[model samples]
Target chain A: MQELVEVRWHGRGGQGAKTAAQFLAEAALDAGKFIQAFPEYGPERAGAPIRTYTRISEKPINLHCGVVNPGYVVVIDPTLLSPAIVEGLSDQGILVVNTNEPIEAVRKKTNFQKGKVGVVDATQISLDTLGRPMPNMPMLGALLKVVPLVKLEDLYKNIKAKFLKKIGEEKTNANIAGIKKAYEQVRVG
Target chain B: MRKVVAMTGDQAAAEAMRQIEPDVVAAYPITPQTEIVMGFAQFVADGRVQTEMIPVESEHSAMSACVGAAASGARTMTATSANGLALMWEIVYIAASTRLPIVMPVVNRALSGPINIHCDHSDTMGARDSGWLQIYCENNQEVYENVIMAIRIAEHKDIRLPVMVCQDGFITSHAVEGIKLYDDKQVKEFIGAYQLEHSLLDIDKPVTYGPLDLQDFYFEHKRQQAEAIKNSLKAIPEIFAEFKKYFGSAYDFIDTYKLDDAELAIVALSSTAGTTKVVIDELRAQGKNVGLLRPRFFRPFPKEKIVRALSGLKAVAILDRSEAFSGQGGALFAEIRSALLDEPKRPLTVNYIYGLGGRDIDLQQIKSVYADLEKIVKAKKVKDLINYLGVR
Candidate 1:
């Protein structure tokens, strides 16, 4: 990983975009790296579009403004994929989406030709594993496949430790299963 | 042993409050600040702290309850944001004038009209003269540290005043970052125990709290309060030194970043200062000789420390997150300019009223401010006394 890696997550309200960003940052912190995570708050309601940011670095992060040029953009809701979503992404930045569509189709939708694109059927994966439509965990799995900011095992340990108490054993295991499935199935091109 | 944990500024404040384990916590929930109340409430529910948590009806009631609890000789604490702090205005002043050592973590937010719930310094800046010590924080770690230190500052023998530990709403309050927390035993030992000299609950010696001394001693009493604040200027350093001895991180009224030999610098506060440091580093990498001076304490304004830090600078841009509406400039700009009046060789300073109403101030905007400072250094004068940055 580089000295600093900034990731922006685009998701709708109630989809856990903010949670995913925080989870990634916390996992980075557990791995002995400095991190920051925050959501761009607005007049938000359920199903409303929201953006969250995560920054991981070897050194302390001093920048407090919104992440403008993110090295990676994760779109948890496939409906949010657009040219605007790719705006301000670095030329070499990677875009990951939780869509059942092929990587080519996702790239065509976002017009994000500057860098590689990763696609995964995270919506289906979440439904199959968690028995619910929570793509946040699977989307994070897809993101790590492209960037590998934190090791998969470390992220799994963090998620299990963080969620087991709040979500209980069965749901926590299911969430972890979804992550592993998405990690294995995500296709990047 | 100190523990490093990733938490938001609100969480950090609550964690500090948990460690302090005040006798009473009377607060009403407000956005950005709601998390602190919620986090502490969880601790209370989980039996982590022995505190009487009061879920007040309104912010007015919150401050009123805090005043009551504090006067009764119970170590007290509370948390609120923009409108919440404004709503507590009446009791807020009373809490300070009555000299109750209440500590409140004010998550900075813009006051309403159009009714915005976003990051701004207008809330606490408005209460600048409410006779409370105001300590601004740059990040979650600072938020945690400042809240702990405020207990000592507010409850000091010479400085029996309330304190508002302010952090930028959402910017730091909601942002999660790694923070180092001291052991509960260490914090307890550092703060010791609150022992009010004249407790209202003391039956043997009755004391008057809010009495009307119309023409006789009101002026004299107010003078005593003024002296108390001034006394803090001397007492705060000793407390800070004590904190450093225990925590290993030194704090001061003002924090300077590479400003000693720099020709250009930016003066800012809270999270904006953190962002400015990044810009300073980038500019310094290109040999721009730029730096930053961040004021940690706003109330009892650290004029001497600030002026001393910017002494050798050729020019500076003072960034204000809230407008003073004085047609002169923002509150910080006014304070900085006034502080430089006595200095024979002071930096040519310009005021940039930016980030009002929670508008994002990016690195480019900060860099541009430095660029303006460089221009001012060449011109040897400021073109505009008050300029707006990142504003439409």
Candidate 2:
């Protein structure tokens, strides 16, 4: 296993992409991995393009800049997809997209030929399970399929513990369902 | 028992505040710094602490309230960033001159004209000589520990000065990372209790604070304050040793990463040092004698130790996150250049001002810095002495 793995996330504001990255880092920490997760801040507004990053390692992750050449690029919004999304992805990297499109089509559309790709119908999954179009939780589920950096069981426990009080059990359970559904339904190539 | 948890720098600092439970927290929300005071405010709301939460109208008012609270002999704290810190500039100096031990977590942000709320040292660097003790951290864990340590450092009788526990805004402030946290009991026991020696509220032994001091005693009072900061050099090691004995993380005024026998080195502060360390490891593997020196204490400057560390090196690059625009170099570059004046084997030194307005400093850029150092070493002379890195 690689000692360090860097992941970049592309999404729009208010989509919880930052939150998903936070959860991923926290879950990796739960698994005893040193992790850093942060979102790029700018004069960005809701539904505008934004970026977030995560770095997980067996040792304390010391690099403090943004993730430029990422081992995994997780796109939380299908509309935000572009060739630039995978511009600096490592050759052995994996790109995960939250789209209903087939894996082959996502690869073709993004022109992400350098790395392995995964696609999930996260929008549909979120609408089905979460009763909304928030793709953040589902995207994390798809990311888990591409890179087992954190355990799903641990993520679930974390989600429950962090959100159970503020968001209540019902909404937390919905997010958990959204995660599981996306995990099972994601197609990797 | 200690708990290991994943959290951001702001959250971690707030957690430390919760443990310390200072008498007052005067705060105004600013980007990047908002999370810290917000988290602390929640603690106040939930009655997790007995802190008097003063939600002031503005940053100036926030600092003013802090000065008032501290003068009344309360263990005082407040947080701000960028313009917020700028707004509190007047009171910031007074808090120090009055010898009030108010602690503040300054989320490092670029001061504005273009109005950016990003990670940079400009905020704290601008206040370097404001009579406050400044400590920078590379990550969330360090920020947490530094805030806890800042309390002791600020309140020390020998070093009764305000302290700024700074971490990179957005980078470390917002970034979630795994950190080991001491138990509440452990933290409480370690910090012990803060007892104010002089209080305006002490009717029987009253003393005036921030009173009108005309030129007659102003210079003398300032000299005394300067002497107090200089004396803090002795107090820091004592508190640092005690902290390590109890908490098990030994910290020093300056942290040297692989600098031993290094021909070239990079000097930086805050999160940039973390990235520079990665570059150092990569170069070390390639048999390059390179290292990094991060100054944990910036106010007292750690002049003697820094001079000793860079004396024998072939070349050194001082990286500054804030621009002095002095046409010479950044503030750090100037200080370091002055410090190395008496060194017999002074390394060829250059300044690289970088990461201003939260610009991303990749590993390649850090490598280029070392490459520049190598060139300087071979040429036996420095060229373009003050340069910019990761900037067009």
Candidate 3:
């Protein structure tokens, strides 16, 4: 059987890659898929590149290992465009990179010969909207456009479940606005 | 009824502990073993089980917390692995010698020098002399069942020693498999109430815990603890029978598979036995006489049973993960050789040190183990054979 629509998140350690993976799964979990979101540990001090995963399926996941093959590879940091991270992009997979650069340049660094490439200047979008250079919210918006399994409403509901509990409503609304602007600026394949 | 789900060894242990309803569980996070503590932490967070979960800063604090909790007359539990267990080395013996029935799951990992994390029996091997009732599980399913059974064995009126339900670190702790948890009613009925009244902190009935027991009175107390630990030998089978009557999972303290007429046997503990069984069966199909003797409980090591089981075999290979620096063989080899000394007819026993420092042991290595067994049976002088899951 085709398993969960698995997505791999690539970013530097301080850049909220694990948070992005978790929020993606939580958003889709509210849509009723049994999801597993986990971060693979690394030397993972402040700025080391980190890899994480989000898998959304109609069935329970028994495998807790890394996402061996992914449906979408979301690179939160464009500098992490290496073959090591994108090694197992499934034939029909999509690569979403957060950079103002051309799609082919990003594609040149990856062995993902079959992925439909997406490029977005998420830092500029986040700073313009949320006033922080958090690429997670915007990269997620790009991810939603490419993978469309989860509705926009479910993402906010799940984000509120996480952020609203930690920060207040004002910061949550700012994040939601950042996500909204991301939907407008984040490129579609 | 408590639900059936696919879970790792640690998750199953946490769930089963909840089902049996321990009063307090204090544990700290350590790799391969962290999952168990995290599982219980979630239980404490969700309030699915009404057990007090204490989060400690380190393994020493975790064991210390468990000692305090158990002394206060609560059925307390905790978990650790490798160096973490090493860190708790002094306290583990104290918990056992004091006769506190705290059940812990030691997710066995390699002890560190170069700092690695994976599966091995070396950690528990290092703690073999610590007097804890050690029960090594062979699979994810057994890890769950053994956690429940360990509590029963540890808490038996005759046996008040703390039990360590051990499994190979990531191999069992992180590997997901199918397992059924007992319903609260069944587990509650099976384990019954934890009937102890020695609350060290109770103002109404004041008591002292861990007061220095000098040789005279303390020696007898140590003897009594040893007696309690030994009494588990009988209780293990009886409790297993009762558990089988309810849950239909019949287990032996020492499980002997096809040793009946086998010429050779490979003995192992923890998750290695699962893959070893497959090797045993494949070799059996080819008419090669090989079997697995996986001992579930280790403290009151089934010395008589092992001697009796090996009576008919021509050769035995004892696999040990922990090194015995001063000894001629690994610790397990010494124990097995010492136990079989009284047997009238015995096999030529060999010691094979297969895994250390969390090296992966696959079915290929298992198959290779059988070939070594064949050679040992033929020669009877195959001592100190190091099976290299590590060398490569």
DockQ of each: 0.94, 0.90, 0.07
- Kindly indicate the candidate among 1 and 3 with the higher TM-score: 1
Off by over 4 Å in 2: none
- Candidate 2 lDDT by residue in tens digits, B1-392: 66789888999999999999999999999988999999999999999999999999999999999999999989999999999999999999999999999999999999997889888888888999999999999889999999999999999989999999999998899888888999999899988888888888999998888879998999999999999999999899999999999989999999999998898999999899999999999999999999999998988889999999888999999999999989889989999988998899998899999999999998999999999989888889998999989898
Tens-digit per-residue lDDT, B227-300, candidate 3: 77678888778998998998889988798788888888888777677667767777899999888887777778
Write candidate 1's Cα lDDT for A31-150 as tens digits.
Answer: 999999999999889999999999999999988999999999999999998899998987699999999889888878888886989999999999999998999999999998887899
Candidate 1 lDDT over B1-392, as tens digits, reads: 97789999999999999999999999999998999999999999999998999999999999999999999999999999999999999999999999999999999999986789998889999999899999999999999999999999999999999999999999999999999999999999999988999998998999988888799988888999999999999999999999999999999999989888899989999999999999988999998898889999988788788888888679988989998889989999998989998898888989999887789999999999998888888888899999999887
User: Which is the winner by TM-score between candidate 1 and candidate 2?
Assistant: 1
TM-score of chain A of each: 0.98, 0.97, 0.92
DockQ versus reference, model 3: 0.07
DockQ for the candidate 1 complex?
0.94
Interface RMSD of each: 0.5, 0.7, 7.1
Candidate 1 chain A weakest ten by summed lDDT? A105-114
Model 3: residues with Cα > 4 Å off, grouped in runs: A1-189, B1-3, B201-208, B383-389
Candidate ranking under TM-score, highest first, comes to 1, 2, 3
